[model samples]
Target: MTYCVGMLLDKGMAFMSDTRTNSGVDNISTFRKMFSWSVPGERFITMMTAGNLATTQALISQLEERTKAPSERKPSILEAPTMFQVANIIGTTLRDTIAARALTGPVAASPAPNFNASVIVGGQIAGMEPRLYLIYPEGNFIEASPETPFFQIGETKYGRPILVRGFESHMSFADITKLLMVSFDSTLKANLSVGLPLDLMLYRNDDFAPFHERRITADDPYFEKISDSWSEALRNAFHSLPDYELDA
Candidate 1:
């Protein structure tokens, strides 16, 4: 269980993912759910994964290895000509990993554990348009549109509405971060499955380089400030909105 979100803005893209993985009451651990690769000024890609740790880790490992291999199997994420191709590689990797794991387990149990993982992939490849996509377990995906400028995966229900009410295609990168803090707060308050230290990415349009990548912890000053201010603002907004009168 986790919470990961990617937002597509006119200026660029913003992403955040939690690092907590819990197996039971006595077993809680930290494993980064975010992965990024870039060719400096040319292209950049970031992925946030949720579900079974083993499957996600294996997929990421293969992607990383492919990037480093002398004779890479195909168009790896690092070498993809477009962001769409990158998504396809990741989707295929995830699906293949799931399929391989099935060979070792009982027929029915194989899919159960692996099918839970999903990925939110977003960014820009040089000479291509920036985009946000959600990759399902079946090696398929859907992209975010102008009308829908965001995609979220994992323990998603709690933090979703904040973006729904406030997200806009034209919002600046900073405002998008504030909105993400509010959304993560909503999920943090409601779901123990998703916990902090969060990895956040901010990419400016056509820059193809990200200088604002952060791992926000429980003690981080900026996150603390934003969380407090947002809670107070929400309470005030709720009270200030005109109440509907009920007719007799």
Candidate 2:
């Protein structure tokens, strides 16, 4: 399992993803679940994956290869004229890969192996509005809108409340980071499979570019501070809330 989120704010987009891949209690491993591509002044795209590690890696590698040989392959997401087309390309690739693997043998047919995968793709194309999408295992997807404004995959339930409570479409980069920390904290507390070392990407709208990107490791000082501060804040909030002292 993993945890990833993409928010479509009035300013632009913010994305965060965890590194942990669930194998088993004893077989857990760390693998980056986020990737991004930029075409300088032309376009910027990012994908945060969850589910089967092998399947996700294969899909990404194929996309990278296509991107590298643009003339020999269909236009990669970064080269697509619109974010919608970019998403279509990714979804097709994911579905085709799954089909191809299943043809190989019974081993591929088994769900125990790494074949279930999905991705969250978010970014911008020059002339169009910025967008966010959650691509599912079947290659179908849904977009984020003003009403939703955000999308999550993998161990999503635990972290959802925090996002709902604090997210604002007009939040600044700093405030968004604080909201993300709370969401990450909730997931970390409830799910063992979603662990540290996150990938973060922030794109300010109309730039046609990704101006900020970061890899957040376990020992990152700012994250450490935020975690500590949030803990204290939560404890105080809990104490201050009126309690149910029924028999009185």
Candidate 3:
């Protein structure tokens, strides 16, 4: 399991993803779940993955190879004229990768392993406005909108409430980063599968490149402060609520 979020903001876009992967309690590792590609002034694309490790890795590998050899691949994300087209290309590639794995892996007599993964992709092209999309395991996707300006994939429930309550379209990048840290901290406390370090990225509108990017390690002082402060705040808030009394 993993946790990843891509948000659309008035200033631009922000993304965060945890780096933990595990087959069992005994087998745990850290692997990057976020990736980005940019062409200086032309375009910028970022992707976050969740679900089967192999499927996600294969999907990312193919996308990377296509970017390096766009002429051979024909329709790479870097060459896609619009963010919508880029989403389409990524969705199609993910669906095809899963299908190919299913067909080539095991015989039909037995149930195949789960080769399913989902992706959150967002970015901007030269003339187009920034866009965000959630691409499913089946290749279908939906774009983020004013009504739904953010996307969260994988182990999402533990960290969703704060985002729903606190996210504001006009919030500054600093505030947004703090909000994401709280969200991730909550998930890390609740689920062992969602361990850190975490990857964070922020893009300013029309910049076509990341404005800020950082990896928050377990010992990072800012993250530690956020976690402790959030916990204390939550406890104080709970205590402040009027206590319930049994009916007479």
Candidate 4:
């Protein structure tokens, strides 16, 4: 399992993802789940994936190959004129990969390997507004709107509340990063399958390139600070709330 989030803000877009995959308690590994491609001053794209590791890996590899050698059947992600088209390419690739895997054998049988996966693709094209999308296993996707400015995948429930309560359109990139970190921290604390060494990408509006990118390890000073601070803040908030009293 893993956790990844992409946010759409007035200033730009921000994405964060964890690098953890586990088949069992004793079978654990770390693998990068974020993929990106950019053409300076032209276009930029980033995708975060979760679900069956093999399925996601194959999906990304297929897309990467197509970009290198695009065909009518397999168009390059960079060639897409619009973010919407880029998303369609990704969604089709994902759904096709899973379908092919299903042909090999039963994906849902007990002790059977799974071939289900999902992705969140976010970026900007030279001529259009920045966009964010959540692509599902079935090749269907939904874009972020004013009412829903962010999308998360993999172990999402543990961290969604923070985003729901904190996201804002006008937030600066810095504030958005902090909010996302807190959300990731919350997910990490509650879920064993999602571990650290996080990938973060920030793109300023109309840049057509990544504005900032970094990796946050468990020992990263800033992330450490955020985790500690959030714990203390949550405790304080809990204590500050009024307790209910029963009439005797």
RMSD of each: 1.9, 1.8, 1.4, 1.6
Q: Best by lDDT, which number?
A: 3
RMSD over all Cα atoms, model 3? 1.4
lDDT of 1 by residue, 97-156 (tens): 888887775767733554457999988976788988999999999999997778988888
Per-candidate TM-score against the hidden true structure: 0.93, 0.93, 0.96, 0.95
In candidate 2, which residue pairs get closer than 3 Å at backbone N, Cα or C atoms, i.e. clash? 1-22
Q: Model 2: residues >4 Å from true position, as ranges? A: 107-114
**Considering summed lDDT, which 10 consecutive residues are worst modelled in model 1?**
107-116
Clashes of each: 0, 1, 0, 0
| Residue runs of model 4 more than 4 Å from their true location after superposition | 70-73, 106-108
lDDT of 2 by residue, 81-133 (tens): 88889899999989888777766647645454447789899988777788999
> What clash count does candidate 3 reach?
0
Question: Least lDDT summed over 10 consecutive residues: which range in candidate 2?
Answer: 105-114
Mind sharing the TM-score for model 1?
Answer: 0.93
**CA lDDT of every candidate:** 0.87, 0.86, 0.95, 0.92
User: Which residue pairs overlap in candidate 3's backbone?
Assistant: none
TM-score of predicted structure 2: 0.93
User: Residue pairs in steric clash, candidate 1?
Assistant: none
lDDT of 1 at 70: 49
